[model samples]
Target: MLWRAGLTAALVCAIGLLPWLAHTDPALTVLKARSAERTPAPETLRAIRDQLGLGDGPLHLLAQWLGGLLHGDAGRSWVSDTEVLPAVAQALGASLLLMAGAVVVAVLTATAVCARTLRLGARRRLGARGPGGTGSAVLAALPEFLVASVLASVIGVQLEWLPALGWYGPQWMILPALALGLPAGAVLGRMLDDLLPAAFAEPWALAAAARGVPPKSVARQALRRCVPGLLPNLGLFVVGLTGGSVAVEQIFDIPGLGRLTLRASLAQDLPVLQSGTLALVALAALVALLARLGVRRLIGPALRDGALHSLHRPTPPAPRVVSLVYLLLLAAVIAFGLPRDPLALDTTARLQTPSAAHPFGTDALGRDVLARIAHGALTTLGTALAVSAAALLTGVLLGLLPRLSGPLVDTVNAVPPMLAALLVTGIAGSGPWTPALAVAVVAWSPLATHTASLLRQERATLHLTATRALGAGPWYLLRHELLPAVLPPVVRHALLRLPGIALSLAALGFLGLGAQPPSPEWGLLLAENQPYVERAPWAVLAPAAALALLGALAVTAAGGARLPRRRRTPTPPPAKPGPAQPPATPGQPHPARPVALTTPTDTA
Candidate 1:
């Protein structure tokens, strides 16, 4: 555990060096930012380098930074020239307070939603058709930024229920908490909905119920069983709280670490950025440690022996209702949802809020928000689908081919996806294809690794060997046996990749590397509307809501929620082949063969 924590710390430090890779001379960028009027001369660059000890190698720099960190010195901000630790200290309390509130809100929301879901249809699978499932899918789809904007607009501006912006009374925290917590709650609820049913179906649970145990008591036992699996998500939730609230902080004008980090990135304040990265990573590491301890305490011996895989796989699904819902959503967005000319400007109505004339209102440039979102849906959803398809196909091809060795695939999987995406985007240059290509390049690694593993396992199966012995060729085996066995899981994996691809596209777009202006991509909309959020919050909220919808549709279509891991027993070995015997006629007696019963002494 200590070594794991140390590894995480090392990873965080390594990540901090990525910016330096992007900018070969980060000192130049910093120096240039300090004085924009004059280009940083060679002399000025040398002076800056000497001041920061920039001539030192990467290891030396890392060591120096680590030493400073241990001494409670995070150096000073490049832009503000204030001590990084002090500045972060000022913001840390606010972020931690906000996160605590968010955690509580998320827990309550998840519990209520999941309980209701379980009560409605405990036996039936949770699907998009169910209200709880649909609502969760929708909520889970929304990114923090969009949720924050909508909350600000509806709760704060229109209804006057809460303050639109600022960190003031407890009421201010409520809206931000809701924005941060609701989506997280939805994710947790969805996971619970998937997990609880399996727990209820366990043999011990069934036996308890059969013995006239109270329903509530039975439920408590089942839920207790779920604790081990669910605990990890809480750690993830904490990590999410540390990093995913940047948009929330920005929208609400809260003095949180997220807001500070965003501001620092924009200003190119290296010290603050590095410090913020380390702080978030440290928080994540601490949460991971706590989660590990909590699991050991809560789960105990069960944690060690719990089955890790399921042998009784579900039957292949037919076209589900969720598929139709996705189609209908796309059709509706294209037909009734879109306004006239999404990109066209109307200077007269610039910066307008939601009104009868324009349902989603107008942007700073007078472009209809509804129109842009409706059109952007096609681009965002389409790109996600394309990238997912490309990745899945690539993974399948590579996995199926015997030429690609396990070590090579493992090496590819070892490369961090984000790092790969950055490298691809850097080489390719920013364009619409950047996000899709970057995602495809990185996403294939996982699918290929999983597919290869599954194929190897399948190859070892007696049935497949028997088929091959019966004169089946490689193509026949691949097409008939391997395809049927591998297709279901592979398809599920592809579907799961869709939402991630969309999120990646949005992230890249936020960094100005995805779909450019006039494209109406959701990420582009978020970036373009940041400055106008005060006046026309609808512009930001509309597209953000659309992104969430698209994400939800993708997830729902992919089977709504992840299924819990089931306990597996080792498969018994296949029977050995016996000597051939002459076949007897139907309904006729066959010749009896002499059989010898042998003991250990008889063999001797």
Candidate 2:
């Protein structure tokens, strides 16, 4: 665990070195010098001097790295030629403030939602919170900007309650934080909603509660048992707080990192661009690493138990209760659209014709306005669902197999997913698949790393030893044993991955490196309507709206994203007149593991 955390810090430090490396590279210097009509020799020399701290010596690199860590500065902006420290510093505070604000909101909101599990007679209540609720879903579906916009428009603009711009001041932070925090809170809420109940089933938690603990005490105990998964998301929610800040920043004109990002994007300022991008990447990497570290920490005790005395517990069965919600969602789509496009997207569809048949009116293309918009929903929703599920599956496979080959796992872990995504996308035609595939490939390593780590933690349990003794083959153990034990956390990890999945897809689509014309993806829609931003702002607004909707749905479904871990055990025939307490060892801890014991028929 300590080693993994150290590795995480080291990698972050390495990533911090990239911008400096790029600036100093001879070829890049030559290209830059040529562009500026200067001699590459002097520029290259100067660049080298700068990066190596040649004049500054080790102290310079040390200064920059340390400053970046403590203060976020890597020298002056290579493009802007200003103190990089100030820019980094300025961006840092805003981003952190907004992130911190969101974290507080999400934590508070989710805590309240998860707290419902502790109420009296709450067992009859489900952990599934608001996945099916339209309000949270809609609020979630609304883009951060839109949410902020509406808030500002009503509260800030008309009502004159709060300032609309700036990430500074308590007043400024209010709307942006709400905008960023609420959506994430919704997601986190959904994730823990059902999970809290499941945690209620954990042995230690129930044991604690069975001791006549208060309801709140029981809830807290159950929550602790589930920390193995929840802790990782603490890192993930930070991303949403950071990534989703762009819109809120713009709406409020906050001087935060997201605002800087907006400027960097529009100006095409490479240094600011690179630096801004680097900041985002670094933040994401840090979050991901934090998640990994948290998982490792969680497994420490489990590892100790496994190593000291194997559990040798029986394997449990996989839950057959699949979420039919997807299929039901399909039905909902159909039901929502009576003789309308089931997919709900109308790029060219017009508005407000208001006929009995064409109630929503026709689009610019004269298509069924209602049907076209409806069909459009398919493109965004289907793509999100399919791609997210795919990336998740890929990551899960990669994360769970460290025991298969330790060196291989290390090798995979060493390379960052961002780079992997860049390489694959760079090689394979930098289209939508490039990033999507990149996400699947790159994002997978962490999950794979964590999955394997968690499973390893449980390998020494008596149950595992007993299974081995029962002649259980590796395949059987994997299916029935390891999988169920870690299934809840694995599900949690997948939930955490959904946001990244959506972000990657949206990013690809946004970059014009994704779905092409006529695809109507929210990202592509942004591009298609870029020309109309001034005249028909709805074009941009609509696609942005789509992104928010799809993002919200995914995050919502992920709330109770788990399948049943334990099912009711059938009643055994009435015991004979013998003792009620049976021997602790079941079946004498079979000497030979079953060939297929990876899978089991019951939970511990």
Candidate 3:
């Protein structure tokens, strides 16, 4: 709780300092946003500065803003010159609705998937393969932005099924909700699927089945047991939805907090930006608190009784065929894209359909689509790899020191990658490195959490105790036991997260917070060609296809990295039946038996 409060305070302070840190004049930026003219008269500049209190300095202005916030005041926006609280409140309400709808959709989708798997008796089969298997991987890999673009183009524009542009009614929320929910649902379903087998394999579940309990009843019981394990991640998903919806809101033109925050940051509207950040941070903290309480209520007894030792099991590697297929597709994309010049433009062939000269069709600028995607692979994929690798290394190291990393992880994890990108852009200004930097800030938390949890389990093993008793030094134990035991799983976690990191980068690029125009980045390609969707759909499909392929490859490859499972403890021989004690009187307690306890060995 202290950490959450501190994180919220820190973020609010950081947002307040953005104008100062960026070394730009907030007044000038606001003036430019207000008018088309780049330059304004001295009188106008002075008037604007005076009105917005720019001369008060960032500290004094921030202090004044904070003072006002204590009494239900958020000040007024520099851009609109209206009460920031009301505008922020409206945006927050919309975002809350969107997030609530997305969460409901995600929960239902996951429940349906898990129910199907359990009904088909595929729990063990799917669990062995990990998560939702290949299908979920494909679904999870689809970025929200890409999904939104396709849905808006096909369902909104082509089929005329729903209004995708505005948020007038509940009907307007469906597409954006689905776009956010489906991918999150895939992820949640996979996680639940991975956990179901364990629940079903429990002794209680086995006894119920042996007693001829209905399959449906047993399945319900199993789900109940597994849900507690998923609660933390569920909270994460909700918090993530708040930050991840920025692009979706923009695509749908919803005046949600994310879109509002993005606009305010760009325009240097400190009041609006600060208030939005505070709302998001508060939402995250509340979610975290509720999730913690829920998990404790559901699973606390089992943990206290030592009935549950660990929530995670070792994930098996992907099938050879899947890995091979992913590699082949990746190689094919590279082979086709590397040879051509992405920058070579021809006005004569602009917006041409896919042909012998341009396999992926030309964009508005007549540049080779295939060539740009291939080159973009370097920028997008390369950065993702670098960020993932860095996160892996950093997470493993920090995870070894759980005490030091715990608070940091909790605080950083509260801020989603999208929110982090907004903050980074605000501080440093948007550039090629902004996406990578922003992603790196939030990417380490998951891996660190995984490693820290695994480390705790590993330390509790008898083997580790014996090794320490034998005078094995910390470094030796870390190298031979801890690192060996921890690295593979942590690396696998990082690999599984690779696609998401890449997607975040792409989303940022799509939002114009990444590489500028003519860079051929995949996200930028989608954003650049969105307006010409009807003219040439191929331009948009090409990059979207490339991103999807990359996601599939990462998921498949990560699935192929297996971990050595811990050896199970051997069940002790049944003790000779002891003579039953006489029943005690109503007020007297029964005598306790002397029970032997044994430490479990760890032989991974």
Candidate 4:
């Protein structure tokens, strides 16, 4: 516990030191902004540093800042020359409120949807158009902006049910909450639907039922058992909400930490950026610690047993086919939308609102937004595909290896993928390929950990032991046994990561660490036109809509709508165990029952 606390403190300190590593001097930047000058002189920089109790050495300044942080002093904002701690405190209050509402909405909605899906499945009545299957698919595919747009159009523009923008009252948070929560809920609901049957079939659950526990109580017990599997994904969902809310907060004009970070990043406000990043790092650390504790508490027995499996349900072919068809249709749209000159500049016609001649209108530089979006779609798709493939390959190879250590695996899994990607990009420098490479590297940790866990579980099976005793080589066993069992789940896991990769890609682009100027990537378009939102809202809205569509399609491709296939247990070897085997029992727990978040269940 002491070591863990010390490591966390070290991590926090490392994050706080990021500003000092920047090419631009934080003190110089502050002096220039404060003086309202294009460039501050060396003497001015030195004087400002002296006034602020800063020094030339980065480590010295970092140590000073850390000391002040212990005393609750977060210093002053570089851009506004105002107190940083107070500003961050105010922003954090709004963000925490937003996060709480979003989390509540996510949990309740997921619970209801999961219950409905499980009930419908138990009845064996879900169809092509059923709410459980089809609705989950659709909702999972739609990105927050697309969902927000549809809601804004219907609930705001058409019915005037709520304000489309701004943070006025508690009521104003509902829309943003829904925007963040709905996707999370959709993902969580699908996970529950797939895992609940197996949970219900666990020995403990069945025993509880046979002992006169009420059906509702039994079901509640089953849910608690299933929750440990959901814990890591739940952590990811929370972090994704906090990170992805940057776009939503901007669209709705919310003054949360997300919005604050966005403004700071764009304006290069070093002090604000430093404080905001520290807050985010702290949030990530807190959530991670909570998730670990939750998992340990809920699944102590299962963890000790080292059990894991994938969901079991009949895999439907229809959704897979439908998703492919949608991808093809999207490709056609991209082909049709490709412009003769996406980069052609026309200053006279700059910042035009949407019109028939210019479907997505023009940007501040007069580049065709429609063309840019189309081209950017291709880039986004290509990058996501590449990253996903790389991540899968790396994860599968690492997972299949026999000698990986548990402590190393745990350390890897502890780092959040987004944070890792950002750090990688920071080191590798900005380029079109940087984000994809960084994301792929970050993505490997979870995938590898999941694969390794599942592989370890598979290796412990009696049949695998028999094969080993019979002198089956590693390659032969891997090829004939493990690969076949593991491939399907790995594929599904990789696909499910597509939507997240898309978001990360866009985020990198927004930060100017991805596709550069004149490239017209969705995120770059957003960064370029955000300041002109009031004058030409269409400029930002168009690319945002495209990003939403792309993310939705990726989600669909991830098998969000697909049903799970049942696992076929191999015929038992001749009984040779110490204890006599009991008669076949219903709801008997499989050795591989308790699953890791990204691990695939065995499906023969």
Candidate 5:
């Protein structure tokens, strides 16, 4: 709880200090927003500064803002001069509603997916191909923005099934909710599927089945046991939904907190930004608290009685066929995309359909879509791989140091990548590096936590202890023992996370926080061509397909690595001298020789 409070405080403090840190004058932004045509004189700037309390230092402003927050006063927006509380409150309410709807959808979707797997009796081992298979992987990998754009284009624009934009009524919420929920559902469902087999394999579950308990009842009980484990993840999913809604809200034009905070940050509206940051951090903390409580309540007694068994198992290797297919697809994309020049322009050929002359069509600027996507493969995939590799190395190193684990990991993990990107953009200004930097900041936590855990476990093993006692230096032990044990799993974890990192980078781009225009980064491409969807749907679909394929390939490859077989220590040959003692006594058991008990100090 203290850690959560500190995290919230730190984030709020950082948000308060953004204008100063960025070395930008908030007054100028306000002035620009108010009257873009007029230049600000010295006197005008001074008047605006005084009105907005810019003369005060950041510490002073932060203190005052915190005090006001305690008394139900959230200060006033610099741009609108309106009470920050009401605007923040309204936006928070909309965001909460959207999140709530998404949760319901996620839960239902997960349940359905899990049910199908359970019904088929496909209780695969951990890390093996799950029941949902390729379809679920594709769904899980699809970014919310891409999903929202497609839904908006096809279902909203073409089919006219629902209101594509706005937040006028509950009906208007459907598309945005679906966009956020579907991918999340796929993820949750996949997690549940991974967990269910272990639950079913437990002794109690086996006993119930042996006793002729109804399969449905046993499945229900098994699912209940698994839910506690998933609670923390579900909490994270909720927090992620909040962060992810930035793009969703933008696509749907909803006045949610994500959109509100983004607008406030870009405009340097400190009051609104501070309030929104508070709301987001508070929401994350509260959800985490609730999840912790729920897990405790559900598993407390079982834990006390030692009734619950560990759900963790070594992940089985993915099928060879999956890996081969993924490689082929990846190779095909690179082979087809790399040779062409992405920058060539021909205005007369703009928005042309896919043909022998122009393979992925042209954009509004007459830039070849195929060229951009092919070139974007280098930018997006290369950056993601580089970031993941750096993060993996950093996480492993940090994880090896026991002092750096625990609360720090928890605190840092609470901040989502999108939120971090917003903070980074506020301080450093957006650029191609901004997204990568922000992602790298938050990406190391999970790997660090994983490494620290494995390190602790390995340190407790008999062989490591023996090796340490036998005068093995720290570096030697790490090189021969710990690193070998830790690196493989951590690498696998890093590989699994590569898709998410790529998605986050793309998301930042989609939100205009990454790779500016004409860069042809995948996310930027999607953003640039969104308006042309009605005229040329191919522009949007091309990049989205590429991103989805990239995600699928990464996921497949990560899961395909073969599990290493456990090595066994050979037993020492029995002492030949025992035969002499064995001859001693049929009745008297001989003169019992004093047996010496010795601890084995040899590491090998």
Candidate 6:
């Protein structure tokens, strides 16, 4: 395991080096002047070389990176003349302060939502989709951007309790972190929400609960039972949170790696950009590694073997419930999309003389805002689904492959999703497809790792082995053995990611790198109307509301959809035995005709 982790780290580091390596050529672009700063003067270099036993070549890179690792000496900053160590150190400190609070906010809120969702039995009313697991659906649809805008408007703009656009004291981190963490946390909650129910339904849980244990106790026990399955996800979750740092830090300006990356991009400082990107990747890797180790330690031995066989048992059947769910989804898409004029009648419209002829009323563009909103819903939801589906497929393929733990997987995993995304977009040049593709590409790896890890872990279970032993081919194994075992969690995770993807895409759009003008993306809309926040507010609110509604729907769908309970059939009792005696009864019966043996009839 240590070796696995070390390999993972090395792979991560190597992947993290790609951007830096792109700049390693001396003749490349305009960083020639900045390269000199990375190393000391010749005399100082020689002195340091002598002190460190450097024979130059590629050896120095290792020495430098190693030294940087231990003492935080990450070479030099490109834009700021400050030492990379101190500059990032200060920035990281502030980032951590914010992240700590953000993580807490994310965990608590997500856990609360997950708990409520898991307990909600029916999913219809929970989301905007008209009940029945709609909460997660709504959450997923709303995205973090929507949440951010809403909070920023309600709490920051209207109430004026907090500044709408500035990052100030610790209190400022609250809303920003909530914005950043809520969606992610809700996504995390989905992982728990799916697995926890299965745990509760386990034979062990039943045994525990049959003794009159409280539901809360059953849930904890369920949590305990689900530990091994949840461990890998926990690692992935923490790391992904680290990845999200870019947007959050930028929003709050806490000087973290995220902000640095943004600064790097804006200045086109290759070195800064590379360093900042790699720093985030490394941080994410470290967080995941730590979480992985922690989970392993906590899983321990006794429980490990015990848990191995439980979930490994042959899957009962696919819940027709999910099929019902798909039908419901189809119905929703139609209803939401089909409505060309659902809101025709309005007294407000009649009074204002904005009649049915206008229907959705006129936007500042004189186009129908309602039509645009509906179309925008389809566009946004469609984009989200496309991106999410692509990500999910990519993540599953990469993650499920045993090779995921290898060099390539490690490397891919090591590359921060955001950086990878930017790299792809930068290379692909400008287009809506580029961003969408970039979003898909960036989103795939983490999801893949997550999927693969779950499958790999599940691979060790007795049920998997048993199915294999029963002459199941690899395809059969995948269909009969693997798919059923892993699908639920994957579905949950995908649902969770739905909102994040939308939010990230919108954020990219907001930054002017997403969809081009007139695309009507929520983020672009926000950017379009950002100047009007103090005035009309509707322009900003309209799109922000759309993004929120979408994220909220996705989240509620993912986190709130409980795995349907498997009905247990009653066990039949064994037949009862006839009572009493008879060894002597045989002889007595022989004598019965002669008067009941010894004591009978008058044996007297």
Pick the TM-score winner: 3
1-604: candidate 3 lDDT, tens digit per residue: 5755676678778878887877887778899888867677788889988988889888888899999999989998888888998898898899889988998889887877676668743223434533445666677777787788889988998899999899999999999999999888877776667556655655455555545667777677667666765665677678677755777998899998878877887888989888887777677667767866785665555444334433344556667787788779877887898999989989999999999988889999889999998888887888999999999988888888877775666567655465577778877787878889888888887677667755654554446677888999988887667776667656755776777787677767776788767787777787788788778989988887777776677766766464565576999999999998688788764555212221111111
**Cα-based lDDT for every prediction:** 0.65, 0.53, 0.75, 0.64, 0.73, 0.55
Give per-residue lDDT, candidate 1, residue 176. Answer: 91
RMSD of each: 10.6, 9.5, 6.4, 7.5, 7.9, 11.9
Give lDDT: candidate 4, residue 254.
Answer: 82
Could you tell me the TM-score of candidate 6? 0.70
| TM-score of candidate 2 to 2 decimals | 0.64
**What count of clashes does model 6 give?**
44
lDDT (tens digit, per residue) of candidate 1 on 271-389:
77667766766676566557657756654444244322211134334346776876676567667557468888989889897887787889888988877877877777778888888
Runs off by more than 4 Å, candidate 3: 112-116, 120-132, 309-316, 395-419, 425-432, 448-493, 506-514, 564-604
The deviation in Å at residue 370 for candidate 3 is 1.3
Question: In model 5, what are the clashing residue pairs, if there are any?
Answer: none
After superposition, the stretches of candidate 4 with alpha carbons farther than 4 Å from their true spots are: 1-20, 35-39, 70-86, 112-116, 124-138, 141-160, 163-169, 197-222, 261-279, 305-320, 344-370, 393-426, 441-490, 524-604
| All candidates in order of TM-score, best leading | 3, 5, 4, 6, 1, 2
- Residue 364 lDDT, candidate 3, scale 0-100: 94
Rank list by lDDT: 3, 5, 1, 4, 6, 2
Question: Against the true structure, what is each candidate's TM-score?
Answer: 0.69, 0.64, 0.84, 0.72, 0.82, 0.70
Write model 5 residue lDDT over 146-178, tens digit each, in one string: 789888988998899999999999999889999
Model 2, range 222-277, lDDT digits (tens) per residue? 55444554555556457545643655666677666655654543332334544555
